[model samples]
Target: MTTMTTRTVAYPADGLTMVGHLALPAGTDRRPAVLLGPEGMGLSDVERRRADALAELGYVALAFDLHGGRYLSDPEEMLARCVPLLSDPDRMRGIGHAALDVLRAEPRTDPDRIAAVGYGTGGAIGLELGRDGVNLRAIGTVNATITGRPGEAARIRCPVWAGVGSEDPIMSPAQRNAFTAEMQAAGVDWRLTVYGGALHAFHHPPVDHPTVPGVGHHPQHARRAWRDVVDLLAECLPVTEDQSEVQGRLLTEPR
Candidate 1:
């Protein structure tokens, strides 16, 4: 395995002290960075692991927080917070911008070469960042096909790729159509992948805590969605030659 470093970072957003996980690849050279977002339940080990994996791939990754460092395992509590936040694009943008600031401030991050990849609520935040005119290389989201306000999507300057479960009740077919229509009307480069026979949050692993209805995990689709996100990064925010060579050596070196 590639050597990397991980640390917990605390930043303020949404009137709360947000605690996030920052993962840095091995080496001193600055590299491309990704602002990673977590599901509505908030930042968990799953997102932290994703950030670490991104670092392993030679990208600086920060898994941002949503709930002031608290993981909401209760369905009701999660909805109580996420539902209103999702409906408010400004709030979502605030959260996204705060996390972006943290990511960009890192010396290891190449500010000009940054992407945003988020899941569920986090995915919505990434879209909001795009709509708010953040200069991102790309935006890749899973289970967050959210439509922005009137004519707002025109502000998005980069390509967007979204993945959702075909049977996701939270982001239904109608919602997907609306989101795509907005993107099309705004002349944004966008793509959507629907995982057939899957439900909402299908990209997430099964949690031990109670979840809302219509949320289930599909292992096959989860891996596929992850690959799709990685491909998006590879195309839009590729690592430099030095980092790639280091990664190659790490892969071939004997354990």
Candidate 2:
């Protein structure tokens, strides 16, 4: 594991206090920075682990909190907070932009190497950033709801890797098929990974609670999905040097 650093960033914009964790790869003068958005439930321990993993791989990972330090148990309450941001593209943009600014400003991060990755509603936020021209090199979305996303999807010039479960009820086969076709037509360098036999929240295995009001977890997909994240980031946002280890490794992976 690389030497990692974690910090909580409180941004004055939108009166939201977002907690962020930065992890750096060993011997890296300035590493790529990634803005990671948490699921609708808020920032969980699993996300923290993901940040640590990203840091280990040599990127400054910022696991952003959308709930502003408050978490809700009921799904309705969670929706209340998340729905607004999803409904209004402007609000989500502000949050994502602020977090991106924080990540880019870090002295240990390279400004040109910034990416955004998100899960669930956060996935929509990542897409919003792509549409707003966040100037990101890449994007990764896990179990995302792609409603109202077609318009913006076409505007995303950056490469996108979106992962959804085969059994995801929220985003049915029809939706997925349509989205895939749309991205293809839009001329966006896009890739979709569908985890077979996986359901919503398929990446959170250690999290299990009946009243949690969220999807069940799957460990296998979690591991595979994270591997994809590392692989994609290395491909999309490489360092300035001409050397390309990341590209070489990605070429080895089966497309």
Candidate 3:
């Protein structure tokens, strides 16, 4: 059985109230926690599914909200709400910082193993935490940008894995290459995975089933990317019970 909790956090200092879905491993063991930030479309079903999947991996994952529960169907409306934050840069940093603080404060989370992951705009926010020198174990981001480049480059204290689509027009390959150069120069333990033939948000593979729109999902790539993420977590966070079983099977079963 999995443990799931729904909670809301109010950052009065920032005038942002966020709703989060916290999922934990079964039983009383305090698990490593992950904070998930959603894309410009807000916290959607795909994100929740990802969070649940993280729980299945035996971590407490909090899919935190960034839009204050205000979602927009029209692209313009979504931009209307998001553009301000994107423009200022500091707003996203503050939003991510507040949510991270709240997630770590939870009793069921292992504060030392806490990490952050995000999609699209949310991924950028996750990177901001790295730039803020939050001392997380690892960070995962998909289809996001690297703004304030060298300025924030020195702040990342964790391994960063960035999943990108080779075909994504928004965050182009040239940009990724440039960003990689910056990351390398800064001595960041980072991996930039460019999925061949994939498009933006390609991890939203289930989006085709009457689910969220504009979320491009790729099953094979999604699984691969998730495995990569899980591997990163295993390295950075404390191990879990299920992971022990899996390792046992691998060594004893002899392939």
Candidate number of the best lDDT:
1
All candidates: TM-score? 0.94, 0.88, 0.85
Model 3, residue 4: C-alpha shift (Å) = 4.8
For residues 1-255, could you state the per-residue lDDT of candidate 3 as single tens digits? 545544444542247576666666666778888989887778877777888888777788888777776544566777677778766567778888888887788787888888888888788888888887887888888888565446677789999999988788777878888878888888899898898877777876443223234356677887787787777777667466676567556547554
Q: Rank the candidates by TM-score, best first.
A: 1, 2, 3
Task: Pick the TM-score winner.
Answer: 1
Q: How many residue pairs of model 3 clash at the backbone? A: 2
| Each model's Cα RMSD | 5.1, 2.9, 4.0
C-alpha lDDT (0 to 100) for residue 241 of candidate 2: 45
| lDDT of candidate 2 over 93-178, digit per residue (tens) | 88888878888888888888789899887777887888887788998999774744546667787998999888888778888888
Model 1, 103-137: lDDT tens per residue?
Answer: 99999999999999999999999999999999999
Q: Which lDDT value does model 1 have at 137?
A: 97
Error of 3 at 218 (Å): 2.8
C-alpha positional error of residue 140 in candidate 1 after TM-score superposition, expressed in Å: 0.4
lDDT values, one for every candidate: 0.94, 0.77, 0.76
The residue-level lDDT of candidate 2 at 148 comes to 48
Query: Over 4 Å off in model 2, which ranges?
Result: 145-150, 208-214, 239-246, 249-255
